[model samples]
Target: MSHIKDVTGGTPIVLESLWKTYANFVAVSGIDLSVGAGRFCTVLGPSGSGKTTTLMMIAGFVAPTRGRILVSGRDIAALPPQKRNLGVVFQNYALFPHLTVFDNVAFPLIMRRVPQAEIAQRVERMLETVELAGLGGRYPRELSGGQQQRVALARALVFEPRVLLMDEPLGALDKKLRSSLQIELKALQRRLDVTVIYVTHDQEEALTMADQIVVMQGGRIEQNGTPEDLYDRPATAFVAGFMGDTNLVRGVVMAADKDGTLRIDHPTGRRIIARASGFQAGDHVAASLRPECLSIESPDGPEEPENAWDGRIAAVTYLGDAIRYHVAVGENRPTLAETLVVKAARRGTEHRRFSEGDAVRVRWSRSDARVLPPTRADARILPPMQAGGH
Candidate 1:
């Protein structure tokens, strides 16, 4: 994608103490955020997490019940949707079926009363930018899902609004197509240098396309950080599990030191040492261990490893690029420890050969274990033996 200079540059957005409440139910609660000029930020969560409602408020489609929405230092909380001069792309692609792609893309320009000749020129340029230059004569019904989505994007961007808001714009496409569009969309955003605030429930999409990710739960912000920060160091158990797959071991602080380290005793009697600041003995905690952070070896391996557990291989799943092994550990109250072996990291034929009933040792470094605040999601703890594996 080629970089296209436009008038949308250099405009930042700020939401100060923003909130929305209808009767006794609250949709969004006290959100404060700032989107830097030309940055891509994503609000991510499960259903009813208020991500979409927050986006609508930013687009002026839903008025804030309290607080301010500032655009480039000017408050636009009272402005109407059209008066805010922001672009919005919805999941449904909101295109006019009766009009040709060209006219549909030019609708915003027409509403703004730009000269007819300029509108035609700008629409044509946008069509070319979105790789739909030759398909402008076709109606929305005649276009493919991807093409129609491109048309909607072109329409929202053709006017060069200061900020572009996308609410699950790629959610309707197939996985392969959605993945392809994600790359193209990120490239297009950088090319245009437009501030984009995206809302989606897909963690993969958020991780792939966002410069910053704000995780929300129960109509409130759970955590906000860069992709790496959120993935490697989640603040809460919900975030640790929600952001990606991980094994959460619930325990209580058996010992604590002033140097930000603590020894946790699991309910199954397994002890784990982890790093957690500002916690004393007897504090409940959960350790989030990524699958890749663990390694498996022979049960009688000579080397002494930290956080080692002996288990019989219960199940193995072969993902395209990696192999996942679910091992059952502990005697009375067992827990499943999931370990991953990357195809590239496989040592030899022996590493690739493993039977379901073979005994193995699962171990991980102490530093890999991230101690976090306990959550309701972790309250239920491990699944029963009959059900097995998380």
Candidate 2:
């Protein structure tokens, strides 16, 4: 595997006000992004969210309806695909059926008219890099799915292209294989010192592999930041719900303390405290809290915390690693809370376990709650769950 220091220098790729539209439908709407040289940047979004279209435009496969694509300040919008010095690995391998692994990897070098000896040396080295050295003589059909994908990867890297573009290259593989290849591909990209623009709809894959993530929604960028930044402080309601599971509590602000505390009145008649950085009293707000930030405690556990709310256990689901508990307040929708299975089991034995009708208290820290604008100030609250229904 190549070390990060081995490939840290190169020219950055910039997308300036890029846009793509088909007839009346806009696919990518004025996206501006700059990818640092030798960094792994992932474009993440759901299907039909313009991630693929943006990638295609960058690869020169689809010409943009408007805007500019630059490489190290050079305008390459009109450049042919082959002339742009890029390596592309599509979802479908795109390997030549008649060519052996060696020939497949050597194709790029051959096109450049490299000497036969040099081509063999470069192809052999690439094969070793992808851990497919001995299988170079085998046809694509003879190799396993993972091995074939590795050959495709080696082919893309053998020619030492200036930039690499991968469009869901692991989308066709099984989960286990996909995870293994993601680590391998990230390591390889670092070793090769090549700029990479990766596109995927899988949030886990993007969070795990990317140095920076550009989250897209409805043909526009919702947020762009490091994984921790987006996870800890989501900038919008869509980002909070889309990135991970979040509990949204709709309420009206009752008071804003000078010490940065916000008192809010929930529709359920419960009061909660959140940060009051950008909000004022009498304003409507929505608070987003992660399930992991909440916990179910006994009614008699202790004095209520600053942000604790008393509720009844509505439902409990036992996932393999954790137990998910749904707690219902007076009239608000039940909020989900996840706890480690071991902890939940111990609590069940030592304390009054949260049965179908058990009373409990959900608590979190004020710092963990994120307050933002409400979805709709005039939206009506849905009916609360019945005794045994969550």
Candidate 3:
């Protein structure tokens, strides 16, 4: 395995203003993205968000309407799918029903006209790598779902392609199996140092499996960064709302403080003091607060800094490790859609439990509530990454 790492590994991939359109409909907008060698990058979005289209273009399966695809430093935009030297694992695993696992894994080498003996040797080793060592003779239906997935993986990696593109590869498995495979797949990638461009709509899978997560929407990239960066410091409201559970309250800026803060007038007729910048007194804004960031207590229980909203608990959900409470704004609107959700850790006897109709106050630190910036035009797209990329 160590020798293989020195001899075989990934190549950098660059997409320069990649665009794919059909008449009036644009499947993929002009987008610039750079994926370095051996990094796992996941393109995440809901279906029809163009993630699959972008990946298909990269794999040479679909012709791009415009722009270039570069592997390493060379432009390979015009190459055919088989000539691209990239391995693709489709959502269904796409195993041949009639072929045995051994023959399936050896298909690539056989196509390339490798000697019969070497093909056997490589297929055997790959089967072992994916923990399907003794089941090479089994057919796809004879194996469980997870086993079939491993067979698919073994088949793809047997020939050792430079980059692996997986379009929702684990989407068919159950939750437990999918979680376990995420760890195994990441470990296998680390050992081989293979660059992967994975596409999925599952945000948890994207967060867990990717070194870089690219969030796409409406045929455009909303943001791309490391998982921590995307989670903690998202650049857009779309990213914040899409990444996980959050409370979004619409409001208008009432005042701007000197130290990068804003006073917002909420629809509930209360003011929200948020740590933010770049807004005038009259600008409309929305504040994003995560469910876990808010604390709930009796109105007179404790006084905290920042801002507080007096509300009644509208709903209560008991998770195993934490309790979640949905609190309404006030008596006037007891069941508004903009209700605040608060999650409290249940630490045995030290936690305080509340009922659904109990009076409660929700408060968050000034830094925790972010006044989202105004949505910009497509001006945020990166410049062409290659002049002929260096």
Highest-scoring model, TM-score:
3
List residue ranges in candidate 2 displaced over 4 A: 1-8, 142-145, 257-259, 281-284, 301-305, 318-321, 330-353, 374-390
- Sort every candidate by lDDT, greatest first: 3, 1, 2
Query: What RMSD, rounded to one decimal, does every model reach?
Result: 8.3, 9.5, 4.6
The TM-score that candidate 1 achieves is: 0.88
Regions more than 4 Å wrong, model 1? 1-9, 301-305, 332-344, 348-351, 376-390
Give the local distance difference test score of model 1: 0.80
Better of 1 and 3 by TM-score: 3
Query: Model 3, 1-390: lDDT tens per residue?
Result: 011122244688888878887766777888789888889999987678888889999988888877878887678976888898888888774799999999999999999999999999999998987778999898989999778887888887777887999988887788987887789889888887888999988988889889999999878898999998888877777888889988878789988988988889887688789887778899977788889999887888665555898888888998888999999885586545459888888887655478978888898889998788644454323333355532
The ten-residue window of minimal lDDT in model 3 covers: 1-10
lDDT of 2 by residue, 304-385 (tens): 7577777777677775456677777664444332211112433433433567667777888888789877532222222232
Better of 2 and 3 by TM-score: 3
Candidate 3: list runs displaced more than 4 Å. Answer: 1-9, 141-146, 301-305, 334-336, 374-390
Candidate 2 overall lDDT versus native: 0.77
Clashing pairs in 2: none
